[model samples]
Target: MAKDRFHPSSRGLSHHGMLPLFSHHPVVSEFHWDHSVWGSSWLFLIVSVLGYVISVQIVKMLLSFRRRPVPLGPIPALYNFGLLVASVVMFAGCLQSTMAEIAETRWLWQRSKTPFEWIICFPMGTRPAGRVFFWSYIFYLSKFYEFTGTFILLFQKQNLSSGHVIRNAMVVIMCFLWLQFAQSLQIFVLLSSTGLYITMYVYLSLCRMGYAPHFENALRYCQIAQYVSLLLASIVLIGLHYYKEGCSGMGAWLFGAFLDLSSLPFILVVNKQKKQRHVFNNTQKGSITSKTE
Candidate 1:
């Protein structure tokens, strides 16, 4: 310049001066540890790690005291319940932040052009920011943890039957693949949100029926049925992935549908068999009384 122009450093446009990256493009700045989103995610990660450690210790202690290898039973129920609560909390926090962002957009004097707006609106095609990527990675890691627990139980021969081992193994594989898919930015929103809820409902229902807290013949049948359903659902998901231009819409719907349908027959068949057994017992008792009389 003929006269040295005094360019303010705040704009970060000076070729000779160094400025923080955020000053240049605040919307697309790299997420840092200090960011509130990353801060909360780190806290959740800590909580998840603590929960896993506590659960493993409790299971080990219980195993040591038992004469025969028994299912974790109530311990798994408690741990799953705690996990459900945590997921809900995290989901609520995300929703609250999204709402706040929407509120801020409404109050803005003019729509400021930013790359973040496009990224958020079209998440499937874009690489998410560091905070989102980190949290998604953590979620996938948690899924791996679930598979690890299932594998450990199966490998230890705690689950002896072929049905039990096969079922658990299939689920472990499904979770592993799902984790990969999630990290790839394939957003089957319904499946991601409701899959855990469906699983929890089925588990709670089985527990209520006295099948989970204690292993019963009915529980075995239920477990077998679930395995078959999951296999079928996985097949359907694969088909949908190819058919829907990789959108996963049909896959998500079918996954939920199959889970709901599969659980019904398990409960019905078990209860029907239980009722038949009860009727047979009562008839035998009556016959014995008649003979004595």
Candidate 2:
């Protein structure tokens, strides 16, 4: 969950010395993402990455010793289903809260459009640390559970490369960054990513059950689209951050932009490869059909 930038400052609290009940409360406050140990600290982030590496290695070593193929059994189903539920909940909760915020703060859209006006400008003002932030926290916490996906991949003996490790690790890092920064644009990303997760796991689960799912290409496109969207947003957000004042966590935004650039090319290449393979498969199928005819 993205922390409210107001939490650290005394101004964000109520004069009565108690937390307010509503999002509209001046002192009501959101989670402070940069608060010491948990948010933006190098110690926590480094330890987390190290722990991830060690734990994943341990699991892979243990699983590799097994002579038989690791039985997936009901685990993947349960994991995917649980993740689907989580994604759905986050999407719905975030969307509901965000919509309410938009309605309440009618200028939000105008602000969003004029990136230079507000991209990095909101730092825990009256913008209600509402449902969106709540679910964002949940999403952040959920990144831990995602390690199970890596474990599952290891169990299936998937290749483990530096790129794979970084990709998996980046999710944790990005989620942490998001919590600290609470960029408004991330709200859209959270919603869209959750929706994509739901769609992806639905097809994945179907395939696991022996269904000949055909949406693999579509899912890949969606995934690629996500990267592309983030890359574009990064450019705009970074540009706006330079000219605008009051946006919190410029460092985090810069780091995020670097990550966006790093990942975009890989995703684009994968998308291109997938497209070529699809076309080739279609061509082969057509040729076979003609021969039979």
Candidate 3:
């Protein structure tokens, strides 16, 4: 037998002999597409986008009403109410999801299993696990909402200075980018700690400068202090997390701490400063009238 011209296993060197472009390979098929998973992720993405848009628009409209000399009616109320409800719902969902991820990660870590392994293998790429991915997406959407709010404040000629604008913009952009790409818990915590500090500083500055109403100033100050304390606590917790659980765990902790500290001041301050300012003006008018008499 002529030494087999080619090993039996070696196919002839021909382009036509190459594997089919659309091989009916079972392994490839199974890995390529999973309808249920894809469908759910897609649906989540769609709802997220829609909710984000609605929230932004509502905020803009409400801010416009505040700035208008002749206030806009009924429509603004509807927008404001809708935006509030939507925001609360979205925030709740994000918190619930984040809590679930934390629990899962903790379980894996405690069991001496690789939690990051599941996260890494998720979505068949370096993409985070579903929980991480969803939360990260929500974080990005929240940043967009923040940016939109900032823009409205800028347009309304609100008390935000250039420094405030630059700082807040940087924080929001960094937050969005980090959540989208880094996905580490340590970085998340650090960013959040810094962001909350900056926010509190800016808000307090605005109150002190008389941008906010007088009665509200004290309350706003109190809120700023509270957030500052919270920021400090978060920073410490994040540091501990980094030491104990590596970067990813730290990141999740920081992200949460930042969010937790975000609205605390806003809620506490409300229009308290405005009320004080009104009282002061009344008192001043009375003094002037008494002098005139």
Global lDDT scores for all candidate models:
0.41, 0.64, 0.42
lDDT tens readout by residue for model 2, 109-227? 35443423333244433232444556666787788788787888788776565666677688778777766665545665687789899999888888878996899879988887887
Superposition error at 166 for model 2 (Å): 1.7
Clashes of each: 0, 7, 15
**Per-residue alpha-carbon lDDT of candidate 3 for residues 1-293, written as tens digits (9 for 90 to 100):** 11121112222212235432222122311222123443234455455445644554565566665654333334333433444444444444434443444343343244532333323211111233233344344444455445454454534445543444344444444444443333344223333343443444444455545686444355456546656765665554444434444333344344545555554544444355556778999999999999999
Put the candidates in lDDT order, highest first: 2, 3, 1
In model 2, the clashing pairs are: 1-136, 1-137, 3-31, 4-31, 12-27, 13-27, 120-247
- Those runs of model 1 whose alpha carbons end farther than 4 Å from true positions after fitting are 1-67, 71-74, 93-124, 128-135, 148-293
Which 10-residue window in model 1 sums to the lowest lDDT?
1-10
TM-score, one value per model: 0.36, 0.71, 0.45
Q: Number of clashing pairs, model 1?
A: 0
Question: Alpha carbon lDDT of residue 264, candidate 3?
Answer: 51
Q: Cα deviation in Å at residue 168, candidate 2?
A: 1.8
